[model samples]
Target: MSQETLFTKIINREIPADIVYEDELSLAFKDINPQAPFHVLIIPKKPIATINDIALDDRELVGHLYYVAKQLATEHGFSDEGYRVVMNCNENAGQTVFHIHLHMLAGKMLGWPPYTDNAKT
Candidate 1:
């Protein structure tokens, strides 16, 4: 088994989460600290640290994750308005968790100029 990440902890049922969606391959849940009225986090069950860490063989999995994110947005009642999907790749990019996860932000106007001036562009 892979070393337990914070996400693994949540997956193992050790930690609590407001799960919005789940399947054999992935899981979606509300973020503990939300940035918007309808903020959620989508993550794969596999322990992929980041996008750069993914193997070519995992291409399908990667695509599936994004599709699931879209599905969750539709199911969660944000299909009409729209939402933003974000993935922080590394520490320099403000990635708080090592495990790869997608943040779904909606329910309000999303402004440009992110959390910090250090954004890569």
Candidate 2:
């Protein structure tokens, strides 16, 4: 069996989180480290360790995560302003927690190339 990831801990309520939304298939919550004014982390309740681990049957669940992101943006009153959804794959991509999660970022205009590549100003 695989090890339980940090997200599984959150899903099981083993650790405390500023939960924002929850449903049968997924959960949404405020990120401990906010990247945007309106930042949220939406994750599947099922423990899928990484994006590469997602099975064929998980397509709907994955799509639901994005749907939840849309719902949250509208509920938080930022849908009209737009938002960004991101998923990191592995260490090189900055996937800190093993379990897959989608980041919902908004409340301010975001820049392209979200990260820097050591470019000069």
Candidate 3:
């Protein structure tokens, strides 16, 4: 069998996380290394390596992930103020964890393009 991803461990209760929201189909938790004042991760109970790996049959599960993110934004008092939901697809997109997850960031305005290095500009 393949090794369990860190998120899977959290889902199975093998590891602890600062979980904020959870349902039968999904889990939401604070990011260990947050990029914004309010950064959370929403993941599915069933492990899918990345967005590219999501199967057609998993549509409901994937859609529920977004719903959970939206609910969390409201619950955390940031929905109307504005927030961002991001999903990194692969290594090139900065997806350190293989599991499919959505990043919910808010609490402040985010930079545009997400890259500001003059050298890269």
Candidate 4:
């Protein structure tokens, strides 16, 4: 087992989160601070630090994360229209948490020009 991340705290029932879906390998939940109408954070059960921090052995798990995100998006009624999946890799990429996670956002027309100068602009 790896060191505990915030997601782990939520997974262990220690922290509070509006969870939408979960399985042995992953967990999906509403973002505490949402950027859109349907903003959910899908995370792995294992505590990998970031995208670059993921090991070769975690390749399948990474792919599965996207799969589960898509599954949950469909379940949440965002499959037909559209949705955005994001994984911030590092501090420069606006990653607040050190755990590897996928952000599934939809239910609104997202703006273009994804980010600006170390912040979402």
Candidate 5:
């Protein structure tokens, strides 16, 4: 068994988080370090480590994560205009937390290829 990650602790209620949404299989909360005007993280209650660790039986749960993200975006009043759901993979993808989670970003138009020096344009 892999070690319990930070997200696991949050899901277990061992730590406090600014929870926004929760269901039998998922949880959504505000990101401590906001990347956008409205930044929220939607994660499965199950500790699946990372996307690569997702099992075949977890397909539905993974789908539920996106569902929750969409629901939250609508609740946050941004679904109509637009929003972005992002999931970082491994270290190369800037995944500091190993747990599987989706970032729902909205409230403004986001730039493409976030973190670029604008040299590409």
Candidate 6:
């Protein structure tokens, strides 16, 4: 079991979301704060809090998340061009919502290094 989160509420339909896709095992929705023109969040119905919380039994669920990402990318017409699928593990990695999810972003030429910084090199 996992703790309740904002996503859990979204999953349970207590909160409204810009939902795009949903199957028996997972759901895909738009990010409230989209980082790109095409930013979507793919999450599992089971509500595993973090990547570290995943167990061997979750292998298929995890893979299904990837599959959903690919499917969404293809459907949204960014598969050939390229896209990004990311999962933040903790605070340092920018995970605010505790529920594990895949951040799918595209619709432009995304750059590397992910983010800019003021840290001295």
**Candidate number with greatest TM-score:** 6
lDDT of 3 by residue, 15-100 (tens): 99999988899999999888789999999999899888888999999999988988888888998999999888877777888889
Q: Give the C-alpha lDDT of model 6.
A: 0.90
Q: How far is 18's C-alpha from truth in model 4 (Å)?
A: 0.7
What clash count does candidate 6 reach?
Answer: 0
Q: Scored by CA lDDT, what does every candidate get?
A: 0.84, 0.87, 0.86, 0.87, 0.86, 0.90
For model 4, residues 1-121, the per-residue Cα lDDT tens digits are 3777788899899999999998999999999888889889989988998888899999999999999988987788889999999899878788988888998999999877666566630
List model 6 lDDT by residue over 1-121, tens digit each.
Answer: 6799998899999999999999999999999888899999999999898899999999999999999999998898999999999998877778888889999999998888876863211
Best by lDDT: 6
Could you tell me every candidate's TM-score relative to the true structure?
Answer: 0.90, 0.92, 0.91, 0.91, 0.92, 0.94
Residue 55 lDDT (model 5): 91
Q: Worst lDDT window (10 residues) for model 3?
A: 112-121
- Candidate 2, overall lDDT? 0.87
**Superposing all C-alpha atoms, what RMSD in Å does each candidate have to the true structure?**
2.7, 3.3, 3.3, 1.9, 3.5, 3.2
lDDT of 5 by residue, 1-121 (tens): 4678888999999999999999999999899988789998998888877889999999999999998988887788998999999988877777888888998889988988775542210
User: Residue by residue across 1-121, what tens digits does model 2's lDDT show?
Assistant: 2678777888889998899999999999999888799888999988888899999999999999999998998899988989999998877778888778998999888999987763211
Off by over 4 Å in 6: 118-121
Q: Lowest-lDDT window of 10 residues in candidate 4? A: 112-121
Give the worst 10-residue stretch by lDDT in candidate 2: 112-121
The true-structure Cα RMSD of candidate 2 reads 3.3
